[model samples]
Target chain A: MQRLLYSLSGASGQHYSPHVWKIMMSLKHKGLDFELKPVSFGDISKIEDGSFTSVPVLNDQGTLLGDSFEIAEYLEETYQDAPSLFDGPGGLQLSHFVESYCKTVLHPTLAVIAVMDMYNIMSDADRAYFRPAREKRFGKSLEDVYAGRDAELSTLPEKLNPVRDLLTNQDWFGGEKAMHADYVLFGTLQWCKVCCPDPILAPSDPVNLWFERMLDLHDYMGRKAVSEAVAA
Target chain B: MQRLLYSLSGASGQHYSPHVWKIMMSLKHKGLDFELKPVSFGDISKIEDGSFTSVPVLNDQGTLLGDSFEIAEYLEETYQDAPSLFDGPGGLQLSHFVESYCKTVLHPTLAVIAVMDMYNIMSDADRAYFRPAREKRFGKSLEDVYAGRDAELSTLPEKLNPVRDLLTNQDWFGGEKAMHADYVLFGTLQWCKVCCPDPILAPSDPVNLWFERMLDLHDYMGRKAVSEAVAA
Candidate 1:
């Protein structure tokens, strides 16, 4: 059986979609061998039967799955013999909490901070689709939104205090080992690292330290990702 | 062996301390029989030895434990045969994240919103102690801090988006059942309900729905708490 993960990619092969990275780490966590098929944002909907609307549409030997959380659940339930993605009880709830934190708290902040940088790195077709879509969502031009980038970036660390505080007492968000919760956060942080040159987290910050450890996970899967700097 | 939980109470027996409520729900979750001993703010230090300076100092058999997190760990370890508090693997880390969320995000906002109400409900001695201590911490008079109550209250529901989003898909933060994470948040919401007449969460919000379920937990332990309106 062949496994394939369709991921959102940049012009220079940068995998910057946080949702895609989550599945990437999750597949590796379950010890599944898979191929990464990169798709531009404009091409995401055409990945399979044109029914899908996003990246991270996983095809597990013809069994198609969409949505990162749903795919994770599928992986956990199907590959029960492998290491668990949720680890124990409350894992699903905790993972969802982390996801919400990223979606509500962190993503908005990052979108403002990385708007221009993200646009510059995207394929022309994706850039054409991205600007008008995001501008409509923000009710402003991309340039206007990116104008407040520094102020928006300043709030990122404080927003991450809960994660930092959790790390202060435990090695991983999954308690002793990295689980879906850790991957959820790691994917978000990795998105920022890949798209933007400015460090979202300070070097001395505990979150950065955890990110370093996360980068070293699954045979340095994250470390091997092509960042904007490396791509440049 | 006798079990007792020392909780901070107001002049009219209003048990409003969030930390104390966490242990209360936790004890009930573990099905442990215990007494809730109410203490004024000034009476905390003398609860056991003069070394302790907080509520939620749990006396299990002869061993005393301070700090709600520590007491939870102790409970999970001591009552290994009972219903677990930290349900599965990442329970500890997730519980801590919930605690940090309440402490960092919710508590400051609540402190500002409930400053006057909390002060008014306290005993004379506690009022005197709390006013000066909290004022000094905020670098302003309690009255001045309370002036910003409306603004502080407005920011609370937004801060709770992560929790609200989590509750959108799951019945409890502890997944299928209420665990330490659910208790952690329940304690914070219960503190607001006990300390003020104002509703922190809108009655129709999903979070409020979850809070209702939480109140119904442990044989109506939370529902039985004396709220400010009831006390009045």
Candidate 2:
């Protein structure tokens, strides 16, 4: 009857999958105790009878669930007494828009910006699987993608224009407090922070300041991660 | 004690300001009665003792307010018994993100796409005021800006990637029904519809379908507006 989260781990057991971090923060937000079972990219298929293809697959007691948003909803529904991940259905619905923003606006530049670091931190087997998979996805070799990293990095601030504009008036995406929307964005940025040696956001930028506050949330849950930002 | 919304009017008495449309939808959403006072770009300064410089200035029985979001908040607070614009604070807060998305992602492309049509639809006084003002903002003559419009139009579907992704799962941004977030996006597209002969979204696109539904909302309030889309 143990709650277990199957997370994609890198070299030295670093958990850096943005989607996995989303569930990681959600679990902690719900005040739920769980075991982190680290699986490499090659090892992903070996978990749970090879039923799930991705990481952040949560095995809650006997039930198994994948997909971060679905897991967030499941957690909210199951752990009714816990701090609500979404304050209400309104927050819950709009949280999807936040997800959409991250995917459409942030993902392309970040994937390019962090791909090299992400590859460098992976175990040999994971690296073997990751490189070809990602190259095929981008239709370019990993090195070619990494060559454009500086150009991609230059666009990061403009990609984050919406978030920077939002932060000027509110402290969090959740209005007064950090909610699922905040975590969705945090996980996106945290992925880059954990992998890339160069910081994605400028220190003085309001979005970065909000990320600093997010890192301090839940007893510095994000800060505790093995990030290149921390190493630098 | 009539509620009057001062809006920017076009050549044929058309209210085409996106910000003004936001207030228009919001007023109807709250089931409140308000008169639409048409003011051209030149007439904006004459409204409310020349205090505000924007359209969508609401004189709620003599309590003057500018800014669409602030006006929405005021309406939500004053007419508590009416249907909620935001279901709660969560929606209210996330609605800002929608506004930011519309501003950052949609506005740039749309302003360029509709510049010529907008110019054509304006009265002589408005055209006189609008041309130099918009040229100053864009740093190009109206003809030069319009020359690159098709290029701007080409980027629109990609710009709307987030909205298209959101529409796949939910019928409205508000989940079950239309909310302020929907109105925010609706106002953006509705502005283009009222001016531009070239429809921005593809006819079969899911985003366009949702907009069709938005037009049918509140007893066809949006469709009742004078639009090039309807004219075409």
For each candidate in turn, the TM-score is 0.95, 0.94
What does DockQ give for each predicted structure?
0.68, 0.72
- Where does model 1 exceed 4 Å of error? A227-229, B227-229
List A-chain TM-scores for all predictions. Answer: 0.96, 0.96
lDDT string for model 2 (B82-199, tens) is 9888888888889899998899878988999989998998889989999999999999899999999989999899888899999999999999898888999999999998887667
* lDDT tens digits by residue: candidate 2, A1-232: 9999998877877778899889888989999888999898777788886888897899999889999999999999999899888887788899999999899889988999989999988889988899889999999999999999999889889878889889898999888888888999999998988887677788999999999999988888788784433553
The Cα error of candidate 1 at residue A86, in Å, is 1.6
Best of the candidates, TM-score: 1
lDDT of 1: 0.86
Docking class of 1: medium
Q: Which residue window of length 10 is worst by lDDT in model 1 chain B?
A: B223-232
Candidate closest to the true structure, highest DockQ: 2
